[model samples]
Target: MELVVARIGRAHGIKGEVTVEVRTDEPEVRLAPGAVLATDPPGTGPLTIETGRVHSGRLLLRFSGVADRSAAEALRNTLLIAEVDPQETPEDPEEYYDHQLIDLDVVTRDGTEVGRITEISHLPYQDLLVVARPGGGEVLIPFVHEIVPEIDLAEQRAVIDPPPGLLEEPPGVDGADGADGAEDGRR
Candidate 1:
């Protein structure tokens, strides 16, 4: 279950180079030369980084066997992943992957079961947790320490104390009206 760290972008130059949108926090360390990577939706063979260097901002990478612009272009938009051991543990208690947060039970400080985390949005300022309820519409809670007081990934639960009016339904909006109401609830 290796996590995705980068995605191959468009070809960089006339050479075998291609632009890679690095996803790791430590891009320089992870996207080094000679790094073995696996592609998804899964290619015929593994890709080896023959050379990798920062250009402008994105990583310029040259993979072994990909020696032409057309060859490099073929890998565009392909996700690159490294083999990560599942047994490896996180260094910090607060640090958790987005996949780990999905399906976690969301509750209020007063022990009110609000919903379950259906999706996570990575915004410019902060990440947002989309909680899906049984009857009520999705509650968009910002992923901050104040709003999300606690996260027990092992238990698959989160304790949230959202700001006032954060979870209230919009005025004149009802679930039974049509898809518009459901669509408006998302905004």
Candidate 2:
């Protein structure tokens, strides 16, 4: 699987070097020279790091053959991706990549299947899982330990025990008072 590592920023100086805003917390390990990067915007092509170093808390990267300001400027906002081996060990047991969480089934403590995780939204306080129900609705479940009690990645399922009234919508709020809302426990 390919993991996003950084986004290309403005060109640094007149050379083909560009400033990269590292997305991973372990920037030092990911932004090393000779690392292969797949550039998005599709046709901009892939880049092989000729040289890479941290500068002003961001990454300064020089890609092989990209030799001028124009070349670097064209790549602004392109996402940098690295092909990650699935067998590679995770940093921690609890630490899961966003891609791994996607499509996992979500269930209740009573063995009731609630929905399947379709997407994950990163927030300042906590990550939110977007669960798509079979009945054509979505549940916004917070990724808190209190709510999501268990996750079996091998089974591709998660168990949740949401607080009371969390799934209830206030009266007269459009379609918020649906059965899926009750399952999501989003107030």
Candidate 3:
């Protein structure tokens, strides 16, 4: 599986060091020196990490052959990808790779069919499941434990317990009448 480990940020100095927004949980393992990563814009990489450090809670890395700030600047917003063995899993039992979650069937806890996970959006604060709804269109379901109570990978299903009005249109809008409406537009 090819997983994105970091995104190249602004150049740090004249010496090619650039800050990165770490995307993987195991940065120490995946972003270590001598690691060769594939780049997203295709021919731009196979970049090799020459050195790395941490400053101000952010990770800084210098790639082999990229020796100046100008070279690093060219890589801004570039995604660093690592190829991993499919058999390897994260150290934490609760943690999962994005590849594992995509394509899982999504269902409500009470057995209502919602959709299937088409993608996993990794945001800064949280991850969201992009479910391809049965009725067409998609819904973003927060991948938190409270809303997604179960992930049965063996059965290829994710059971979600969405809050009210999350799965469909709420009451009283677009021709949906509320239990009580003021007699007419005059009200």
Number of the top candidate by TM-score?
3
Question: How would you encode candidate 1's per-residue C-alpha lDDT over 42-156 as one tens digit per residue?
Answer: 9624798899877886679999999999999999999998776665545677766666788999999998989999887766478889999869679899999999989986787
State the lDDT of candidate 2 residue by residue for 113-154, as single tens digits: 788999877665788989987777677999988999788988
- The global C-alpha lDDT for each of the candidates, from Candidate 1 onward, is 0.82, 0.81, 0.89
Residue 132's C-alpha lDDT in candidate 3? 96
Please give the lDDT score at residue 117 for candidate 3. Answer: 95
Query: 2 in model 1: Cα distance from truth in Å?
Result: 3.2
lDDT of 3 at 33: 96
* lDDT tens digits, residue span 116-135, model 3: 99988878799889999887
Highest-lDDT candidate? 3
Worst 10 residues of 2 by lDDT: 166-175
Higher-scoring candidate on TM-score, 1 or 3: 3
Regions of model 2 farther than 4 Å from truth: 17-26, 50-60, 169-187
TM-score of each prediction: 0.74, 0.72, 0.83
Mark the 10 consecutive residues where model 3 has the least summed lDDT. Answer: 178-187
Which 10 consecutive positions of candidate 1 have the poorest summed lDDT? 174-183
Candidate 1 ranges with C-alpha deviation above 4 Å:
24-30, 170-187
lDDT at position 80, candidate 1: 91
